[model samples]
Target: MRAVTYDSYAKDNSRLEYREVPDPKVGPGQVLIQVRAASVNPVDWKVMAGGLDGMMDAVFPVVPGWDVAGVVSRTGPDTPEFAPGDEVMAYARKDVVQGGTFAEYVAVDAPAVAHKPAALDWAQAAGLPLAGLTALRSLERLGVGPADVLLVHGAAGGVGSLAVQLGRDRGARVIGTASERNHAFVRELGAEPVSYGDGLTDRVRALAPGGVSAVADFVGGQLETTLAVLTDGGRHVSVADPTVEQHGGHWIWVRPDGAKLAELAAVVDRGALTVEVAQTFPLERTGEAFDASRTGHTRGKLVLVP
Candidate 1:
């Protein structure tokens, strides 16, 4: 099997290289997947650069990716939920391994995966697990409903885009902040788009005169700005900054939940959710994908077709 892996942690050292590595074997409660596609998230790059070294207790020669869509090639002895050849998608547990998705095959915990929606292709399904789960978890915390007005920062990016759509599906009125170039795309996701730079708070306030009922700040730098437009005791959440305790908000770190993934799959099957892939690259181009993500302006998710 060929894989993209790094022996050390640094931007300069994170070059892609191919090697004849042994394929992973499934253990108890695990399933081996023939990876078709995997999406890159900020966590991927962060882990690659050792940003979470203290938190994760990572080892060297890590492969960093969590979002995957593939076909089950083998199931462990005790696994009864799925069989060989089942199409599946999942977010890998962040702590077990840095990432195993940048390869032809990888072993995943059976409990972390759900059946992939037949309506979606590998690339689209690959983009959903991490971002979609984050959106679902944050919205659940917000308790958003038809009577509420929800605000999402960085609405054109992966998590923000999904959050906007999921919020709309739950009947919440959504207002999203993005760059001018992504305004139309964000609006198409069922949210009113507000420009994110300079006076963004005022722009959001203008859109929701009475103030938003909840806020999800995908971009942590705009914390103060988002706080300004949220009503008192309004649900506030951030995925980027977990240290944020000042605004009565909680930091949301997405976890692997097959039940939630099942619900997300149903939404996708019913045409209520969509996964947008801005670009796709081969495993050898992992470094380039990280570079693209660092530019901070990708319209949607970036994926790797392994």
Candidate 2:
């Protein structure tokens, strides 16, 4: 199997290389997926640079990816949930960081795999698991609903884009913060777009009048904006800032849950949600993909086709 690997933490991402590696062995409760498409997230480059060393143990020559959309080529014993040829997707994060979704094939625990949504193409399906799951969890934690004014930071980015739609579907009047260039795109996602940066609080206040009922921070460094615009006793959560917990808000980290992923897929199938893909790269050009993701400027997901 040919896969991209980094021998060690390289802040410059100089160690990423594509080469032949041994095929993964399927263990009990695991299923082997022939990788069709893998999505690039900021964490992929961060992990390659040792950003998560304290949180996860990384084996040498680590493969870098987590979101995958593919077909089952093989299934391990006791994995009665799926068989070969099943089209599936997953946020396939394991306790260890060596075997990831960027390879030609990856073996995932059955509990973290879900049937792919028929409405999404390979790139879109690959983009959904992590971003969709994160958005879903954030909204669920905040208990967003009708009669609430929801504020979403980074509303045009990967996770934020999905959060905007999900919030609107829940009947919340969503106010999304994005750049001037992305305001139109954010508005298309069903949110009233507001430009972020200086005077962000005023922009949001102009829309909500009193303050927002909830704030979902998909991009970090928005604690001040969140605190300023949230109504009294309102809810807030941040995937980028753990300090939110100290300020009476939740710092959310998404987990691998197949059941939840399936539910998100159903939402897509019902035409209530959609995944946006900004670009697609071949397996060998992962370095370029990572660079693009690190820029934080892309409007949607960046996918890799293996």
Candidate 3:
């Protein structure tokens, strides 16, 4: 099988190579997915650069991706949830850093796999797992509901965009912070857009006067902004910053739950949710896809078709 592999951690993505690699082995409770599409997350490049070295161990020549959407080619023992020919998607991160979704095939634990949303094509479905799961987890931690007013940082980002819609779906009045260029896009996602900069607090205050009831920070370094605009007893969470824990806010690391992903897929199929794909790359151009993700300006996901 051909896949993208990096020999070692570096400051940049120059080491990424597209070449032949052995097909992943399916262990009990795992399923083999013939990779149709894989999406690039900032974490992919960060992992390639050893950003997570303190927490996770890495194997050399590591395949680099976690989000996959494809057809099930085979299933291992004890996996009764799915069979061959099933269209599936998964947040396929493992404790060890190897056998990722950037390959022609990947073996995923059945508990982490969900049937791909029929409403989404391959690229959009590939983009949904990680980002959607992160947003769902963050909102769940914040306890967003009809009575709460939600403030989302980086509103136009991959996770933030979904957070905005999911927050609204849960009946929260969402206020999202983005640049002038993304205000309309944020609005389209069902949030009142506020410019994120010098007068951020004042801008949010103008919209919510009393203060927002909850905050979900997708872009890190927004702790000050979160504190400034949140109500005194409001809940807040961050996926990027861990220091939020020190201040009564939760730091979220999304767990893989096939049931929760299946629920999210239902939302997409019902037309209450949408997945945005900014661009698509052939499997071999993964490095270029990483370059685009590093820019941090793309409104949606960057996916690779294998």
Candidate 4:
């Protein structure tokens, strides 16, 4: 099998390499997937550069991607939820050492995957798992509902884009913050777009005079802005900065839940949710994908076809 991997934690170009590798074998509760597509997240680049060195325990020579969409090629002994040839998508467990999806094959835990939405292609499905799950967890933790006014930061990026659409589908009045170039794109996702810059807090205040009921900060640097617009007792959640214990807000680390993913797949199939793929590259160009992701201005997810 062909795989892209890093020999050490460094910049994307310093370590990422595409090469032939032995095929992975399934374990007792794992399923082997013939990967068609995988997507890059900030975490992939972060891990590749050793940015999560203290926060996460990772083995050297790690495969970095978490989002995967592919066909099932084989299953472990006790697995019965899927059979060979089922199309599936998932966020592989963060704790895994060698099971990342940036390859021709991956042995994923059977309980971490669900059928890919029939309405989406392999690339779009590949973009959904990690970002979609993060958005879902953030909204769930904030208890956002139809009557609430939800504020989302970095609304044009992968997780934020999904969050905006999901908030609108859940009946919340969605407000989003993004750069001037992405204002129209965010608006198209059904959120009131507020330009993110020096006066972000003021912009948000101007839009929602009564104050925001819930806040989800996908961009960690905008913590102060999110705090400024949220009303007292408002629900606040962040997927980027989980150490926010001082502000009466909660942090979300996306977990792999096949059942929750199943529900999200249903929403996608029903046209209630959408996954955006900003760009696609072959596995050999994984370094280029990481460079684009680190630029912090990608309109949506960047995918790698393996």
The superposed Cα distance between candidate 3 and the true structure at residue 243, in angstroms, equals 0.7
- For 91-178, candidate 4 gives per-residue lDDT tens digits of 9865745458899999899888999989999999999998999999999998889989999998999999999999999999999999
In order, what lDDT does every prediction score? 0.87, 0.94, 0.94, 0.88
TM-score of each: 0.97, 0.99, 0.99, 0.97
Error of model 3, residue 15, in angstroms:
1.2
Candidate 2 achieves a global lDDT of 0.94
lDDT of 3 by residue, 146-255 (tens): 99999999999899999999999999999999989999999999999999989898999999999999999999999998998889899999999999999999999997
Q: Distance (Å) between predicted and true CA of 42, model 2?
A: 0.5
lDDT by residue for model 2 (1-306), tens: 999998999987689999999999999999999999999999999998889999999999898899999999999999999999999999999998999999999999999999999999999999999999999999999999998899999999999999999999899999998899998899889999989888988888888889998999999999998998888999999999999999999999999999999999988999989999999999999999999998998898999999
Misplaced by over 4 Å in model 3 are: none
User: Which structure is stronger by lDDT: 1 or 2?
Assistant: 2
Model 1 score (lDDT):
0.87
| Residue 295 local lDDT, model 2 | 90
Off by over 4 Å in 1: 13-15
Q: lDDT for model 3, on a 0 to 1 scale? A: 0.94
* Pairs of residues clashing in candidate 4: 146-171
lDDT of 1 by residue, 1-306 (tens): 888777777755345565667677779999998999999988887777768777777655666688899999999989999999999999976565545688888889988899999998999999999999999999998898998899999999999999999999999999999999899999899999999888888888888988998998888877788678888778889998776667688899888998899999999989989998999999888888888998888988999997
